[model samples]
Target: MSCPFAQSPRSTPNRIPKRSSSERDSIYEVIDAAPLCHVGFTQQEQPFVIPTLHARSGDTLLFHGSTQSRLLQAIASGRPICCVFTLLDGIVAARSAMHHSMNYRSVVAFGTGRLLEDEALRQQAFRLTTEKLLPGRWETCRQPNEAEAKATAIAALMIEEATLKQRSGGPNDIESDLSGPFWAGVLPIQTVIGKPIPADDLPPGVEIPSRIASLTTSG
Candidate 1:
């Protein structure tokens, strides 16, 4: 099915201005690079925002948790949810405090979570999630057992509406502020993965998997 967001006119209330194909790519890049997302929803008149790992499958976003988890249960109830993912690229220092800003890419999506009732779909979701977390490791690792799958609750959110906001480069300092005696530039930031440490009980001759080895540096 086509993405719901793609079916409508561009006249919508969104904070960010997404007017180009490159900007859409930036949105997807941020979502793919960030492993965690904050899901916001309300339960019993109380608002909640929880962080969890997520995987994007085409126009749908997948996430799972314990079957008995209150958050998962709430989501499965069909209430609307707001999913947010962001990546901080740098800090912009400007001569004027008002002009100071940061470089970031963010995606805000709105959808209602649907529980994956079909066993086959749930299994597929699990596989997709695992692969997204660590590519090539799922093939080498053992699959989940029936009992484990039974205890897990998987859900998919069809991205009905979404918006992407991004800010890059240095601060937009005014002409007068540009002449001030103050340093102004972007302080680049990145997330790096350190060398993997083997488990204490790891059997001998078991070398690091290619997926793990590849994570030794920032990808």
Candidate 2:
């Protein structure tokens, strides 16, 4: 089933409305593809935007931090939150400076965070997060000990309303400037997984797991 996030004034895009979408698949795709998100909220009349790792679990988003983190504490207080996920695809160079733009997929979601108190759900979030960052990693690595688990805080945001905005392809230059002296094209951008480096103090003879090795191959 698709996400049920309804459109609201806060989730609507006034500028470049054509680029915005309410489609659940589109919104979910961007969220799942993004490795990190910026969560914005206001605490005590002061605005704060913090970037952190994130993972999507069904229609809800998961994030975690140190138990004492101010951002996590603010989020778990049920304050209004604006979480944004963005993926930059390329830089659009146009013949005219004003026409330059970037190709990207982004989502702006509105919700209020809630702490994941249940042990099972909290463990599930941790697994999903680890697998999201690196597939098959959770199974290969040692599970978090009780102390480690207790020191971390996990929260969920049940996306109440959200919108997806995206732009693709090359720059949109004016007709007169199409053939101008300046070049116009897209400088493609991508996130590449580089070769893995072993830890300096790691025991010798431990080979890289297939899951880690496959990243570079796929990248």
Give the number of the best model, judged by TM-score: 2
What TM-score would you give candidate 2 relative to the actual structure? 0.96
Leading candidate by lDDT: 2
Provide the TM-score for each candidate, comma-separated: 0.89, 0.96
Please write out the lDDT profile of model 2 over residues 80-169, one tens digit for every residue: 899999999999999888888999999999988889999999999999999999988998899889999999999898888999999999
Model 1 regions lying over 4 Å from their true place? 1-26
Model 2: lowest-lDDT 10 consecutive positions: 1-10
Q: Which stretches of candidate 2 lie over 4 Å from their true place?
A: 1-4, 217-219
Predicted candidate 1 versus true structure: per-residue lDDT over 19-93, tens digit per residue: 222234555667788878999999889999999988888778899999998768877888988888988989999
Colliding pairs, model 1: none
As a TM-score, model 1 comes out at: 0.89
lDDT values, one for every candidate: 0.79, 0.90
